[model samples]
Target: MKIWVLRHGQAAAQAATDAERPLTAAGQQEVRLMASLLQGQPLDAILASPYLRAQQTAALVCTELGYERGVATAPWLTPDDDPCEVLRYLAERQERNLLLVSHQPLVSQLLSMLCEGHRGAHVPMPTAALACVDTDFVAAGLGSLVLHRTPADLSA
Candidate 1:
């Protein structure tokens, strides 16, 4: 299975609540570029953190890929959630392709956990950055990174 994890675009920090935070104009453009880069991929499922930023970013990708607007909100992708559970869940699903839109630290942590079985071993995931991991079900240390991209890289 191949899993694509995308960090949410830049969002304002001073929002009344984290859930209410929205993406900035540049963030929107970043999403567009990221979406364009992923337009040709055949994503079997779309998952996202329930936060506004992640939801917004997922929406852009879905729009570009002609997927439905709704995304499955996985609590494990949330900022405060543990990534190992999510990894285990995905590993068991055996889906061919899955897209997950989430926040930093968590995205990076998840990648590290899958590839290295440890957290904080990889660089932090920047806004709108993506990491593609390929692995087999019920296997540990089987993940290999296929791609790691940022919005800026896509724009360039």
Candidate 2:
């Protein structure tokens, strides 16, 4: 299985609520640039957090990649959600390639947990950052981190 995790782009500092917070103009551009990296990849599914910023990011990715299936809003992709639950959810899915658009701590924790046995590694996922992991099955430490890129890397 191949899993691609993307942290939503930079958002405005304030909003009525965290979930309602939309991406800034720069955030939209960052997400578009990051999405271009996946242009030729075959993504079976695109899952994203319900947060406004994540949703916007996913949309940008869909546009960039020309992914017509659209994004599925997932509650488990929230910043504070447990990585274990995400693993279980991935285990249940049958997609060979999956893209996950989510927030900070969840993206970092999920990537670290996937690459490290017990979430020991500190995987820093800045806004618009992306990471790819490959594994025969979804589980802690069983996966290998094949790629990690941030917007800075893409823009450069």
Candidate 3:
């Protein structure tokens, strides 16, 4: 199975609430570039944070890919949520391809937890960056990082 983890692109510096934050114009372009770069990747499903920025990012990705369905929103993918919950949930799914659009710490921590045994590993996930993990299981250290790219990397 391959899990594609994506971080929402740059967002407004301030909002009424953290979840209310929206993506900037550059952020939309970043996500569009990222989506274009990922056109060849197989995606069976997309799960994303409910935050406005993440939702926007996922929407753009879904639109680009012509997924034709609303992306699933998982509360457990919130920035402050636990990665284990997502792992547990993923363990039951049969889909070989999945995409997760989320925030900063959550995305990085989940990558570390899957590629390393813990969340202490340094995995840089700048805005609109993506990390692809290939593994048979969802356990820590069982996966290999197949690809890690950013909008800047793809844009170039």
Q: What is the lDDT of candidate 3?
A: 0.90
For candidate 2, the 10 contiguous residues with the lowest summed lDDT are 112-121
lDDT values for all models? 0.81, 0.92, 0.90
TM-score of each: 0.92, 0.98, 0.96
lDDT of 3 by residue, 1-156 (tens): 999999998999999999999999999999998898679777889999999999999999988888776799988889988877778888888889999999878888899988997888889999999899999988877889999999878767
The residue-level lDDT of candidate 1 at 151 comes to 74
Q: With candidate 3 superimposed using the best TM-score fit, by how many Å does residue 92's alpha carbon deviate from the native?
A: 1.8
Q: Rank the candidates by TM-score, best first.
A: 2, 3, 1
Q: Which stretches of candidate 2 lie over 4 Å from their true place?
A: none
Alpha-carbon deviation at 127 in model 1, angstroms = 0.4
Please list all clashing residue pairs in model 1, or write none if there are none.
none
lDDT of 2 by residue, 127-155 (tens): 99999999999988899999999999877
- Over 72-137, each residue of candidate 1 has an lDDT whose tens digit, in order, gives 887778886777777677866756989999887788888887777777677557898888888775
Residue 114 displacement in candidate 3 (angstroms): 0.5
